[model samples]
Target: MSDRRLDDSEMATWLPTIRFVQLLPQVLDRTLKAETGLKHSHYAILVTLAGQGDRAIPMTELAQIAGLSRSRLSHAIDSLEERGWVTRTSCSSDRRTLTAALTEAGRELLRTAAPVHVAQIRALILDPLTDAEREQLGAILAKLTPGVAAAL
Candidate 1:
């Protein structure tokens, strides 16, 4: 079959995949916001920094990891700084380099919010799938992530 030769059934099957790619984030964002007072972007930033532990990352690297533009990341960081959930430090090795680290308050916030986030995930996502189905979905998403990154 040629690349353009997708028939009705193939097209129909793929439509949901495309739609899911578009809608999942917004749905998740709503749930996150309602439950934890955290936007999806803020949650992502906090989780990323928390995952990094005591080792701080440069702002640019943090932006890339969180899949945000530099400016957006800067704004989010500024907000977090204001909330005292993060601290920005000048790198000793390179005075020009700045790093963002999760503060004790940030860790506490994440710990407090973790259950709400988990419940949101369960209600909006995992509970909708069987164990096997969840595994398959995870595999599919993992496969797609690299292609999406490549395009970006």
Candidate 2:
């Protein structure tokens, strides 16, 4: 790694972005837990599964999409399974592969949780952004995603 430190200009930009990254999740988790008894990760898993045409997704792919480690996802799946919100099964084509599917209960929970989650998201993040700023933010984040993922 280079020894060069972040300059004042870079620090000014980076500090708030890092702070937002740290705080946003806490805010989201708090709202979801209070309203629905679901953590943000659980809610994300449900939303991802719901988007997958209600079909089972392989555990590995699900972890990637959710930005979780395999072990963390497995543990979350276990909790969700106990709650009857998710199910895991061995893949028919590849017995070594496991798949996760959202249950009817999960769908119901998501339907109820989504509006409240969305409103919080708007209040915390989107409501402050002008249309052009929102578009710019999207573009900037899109450019960052690949590097962040690779770093992870």
Candidate 3:
């Protein structure tokens, strides 16, 4: 493979974009943990489960949707289960597979956290952008998602 380095124009775009990707999650995670006593990962899991309409999802599928490894998802679920926020049970048809379901407490927590989280997201990300810029950003990010997922 050729050891081609990024040109100056490419660097200009890539550096800031990569830095934002790295730093935004840390900032959001810290804020979420401080306000809700949950890390960003936990918040993501809860959000995903909440969106499933009270149905349980297989652990593997949950891990994929949550962008977590199976072990990490399992560990997080363990903590959530201990806190009465989530539950894990054997899948009815496949006894070997475990499914995770959000508990009522989890739903309550999510309801409480959603407003604050949405506000934070707006303040940190969307509020600064103009309507046109927001649309452009959505389009740009949509273009990028598939490649990033494939790389992963």
By TM-score, the best candidate is: 2
Error of 3 at 39 (Å): 0.7
**Number of backbone collisions per candidate, in order?**
0, 0, 0
Candidates ranked by TM-score: 2, 3, 1
Q: List the residue pairs that clash in candidate 3.
A: none
Query: For residues 1-152, could you state the per-residue lDDT of candidate 2 as single tens digits?
Result: 99999999999999999999999999999999999999999999999999997689999999999999999999999999999999999999999999999999999999999999999989988999999999999999999999999886
Model 1 agreement with the true structure over 4-120: per-residue lDDT tens digits: 876899989789878987887898788777877777788889999999979999998898889888899999999999999999999889989889999999898888778878887
Candidate 2 weakest ten by summed lDDT: 46-55
Q: Output the lDDT of residue 43, model 3.
A: 90
lDDT of 3 by residue, 1-152 (tens): 77999999999999999999999889889988888888888999999999998799999999988888898999999999999999999999999999999999999999888887899999988999999999999999999988987775
- State the displacement of the C-alpha of residue 126, model 3, in Å, after optimal TM-score superposition: 0.6
Q: What is the C-alpha RMSD of each candidate to the true structure, in Å?
A: 2.4, 0.7, 1.1
Global local distance difference test of model 1: 0.87
